[model samples]
Target: MPEHCAAFSCSNRRTIASRARGITFHKFPKDKDVRKKWEVALRREGFHASDTSVLCSHHFNQGDFDRTGQIVRLRDGVIPSVFSFPVHLQRLEKGRATSSSRRAEESLSVASQDSQEMATSSPQPQPNDVNISTLNVIS
Candidate 1:
C-alpha cells in the first residue's frame, strides 16, 4: 500500500509526482518528545504514529528541513507545525476559549433559543411610528 500523509486533510501520497514537486515525506522522529510534538501538531485526537506513518513537507516550514545534504532530512528536534486545519478541527487555546465539547453544545442551544425567539417575537414599534388618531389635528 502507498504511504499517505497522516495529516487530517492532507491527501499527499508517496508517489513520483509528490517527489517531483519537492514535497519530501518524513517519518515521525525517534525521540519521544519530538514525536509527541508531531502528533500534537496533527490535531488528531488519540492519534498515534505507527512505524510507517509519514507527514509531507507541506506540513512543515522550509527551515525545518536540512537540504544541504544529498537527501532531504529534518533538522534535529524540529516538529511539523504548518497545517491548514478547518475551523471546527482547530483546537481552542486554554483559558482563551471554551472547551470543544462544551462549545458545540452551547452554540446549538443558543441557536435554538434565538430561532424560537425570532419565530414568535414581532418587531417592536419604532419611536417614529405615531398613532395619528391620538393626535389632535388642526383643521
Candidate 2:
C-alpha cells in the first residue's frame, strides 16, 4: 500500500505519477530526537504518527533533492526545512514581478486592442470631462 502524507490538510499519496515526477514520500526519522524535531516542524495539533507514517515531497525544498546522477534522491541527514505548506503570498508590483506570475501577455494584447478601438472611435473627450473651472481660472 502507498503511504499518504501525514501533514495536516495534505493527502498526497505515493503513486505512479508521483514516482515518475520524482516526487517521493518521506518516512519519519527513525531516531526519536529527529522525529521530535520533525513533529515540531510539521506543527500539527493532536496528531500522532505511527511507525508507517510518511510525508510527501511537496514539503521539501528543491535543494534537498540530489539530482547529480541518473536518479534523483534525498540527501542523507537532510531534514525538510523548506516546507511551503500551501503557498507564499507575494506582492506583484512592477519591479517585483516574477516570470511565474499570474499576469499573462494576452492581457496586454487585449489592452492594446482596446486602445486601438478607442483611437478609431473618437479623438476628443466629452465637453463635460474637461475642467472648465480650471480653464476659466487660467484665463
Candidate 3:
C-alpha cells in the first residue's frame, strides 16, 4: 500500500488492505495542462511527476467518486479541484516557482471558477421536450 496522498499537504494513508475498499489513487491527468493544474493545487516542494505520479481520493470531491467507492471514470477534459489545504499545512506546503508559474495558477483557478459558475447557472432540460429521433419513424 502507498504511504501517503499526493495532494498538497495531504497525509491520508490507505486505511484498508483492499484497493477497492479504501482511499484510492488517481494518476496525474494525461493532458499536460490538466496535470499542471493538479500540481498547482498540490502546492508542494521538489515535486516532479512522471507517468505514474498520483493523488489519492482524499484530495478529490465526493462527486468524483463512483457508487463502488472508487474514483469515477472521468469524462474527457475533466479535472479535479475539490480539495482544500489546512492553514498550517498551507504554510508547510508552499513551494518556490517562477512568476510565470504563479500567473498560470491564478489564471487556472479563475477560469475554473468561471466555468463552474456557468455550468451551475445554466438551465436544466425540460422533461416534456422530446426529439424527433425518439419517436417512431413513419415509413
- Highest TM-score against the true fold, candidate: 1
Local distance difference test scores for all models: 0.89, 0.75, 0.70
- The candidate that wins on lDDT is 1
lDDT of 1 by residue, 30-77 (tens): 888889999988999899999889999999888888899899998898
* Predicted structure 2: lDDT: 0.75
Q: List the residue pairs that clash in candidate 1.
A: none
For all predicted structures, in order, the TM-scores are 0.64, 0.52, 0.47
TM-score of 2: 0.52
Clashes of each: 0, 0, 0
> Model 1 segments beyond 4 Å from truth?
92-139
Distance from true location, Cα of 92 in model 3, Å: 16
Question: Which residue pairs show collisions in model 3?
Answer: none
Overall local distance difference test of candidate 3: 0.70
Model 3 C-alpha lDDT per residue in residues 36-102, reported as the tens digit of each score = 8777777766676678677777666667655554445544555667668677645455754799889
Name the Cα RMSD for model 1: 10.1
Better of 1 and 3 by TM-score: 1
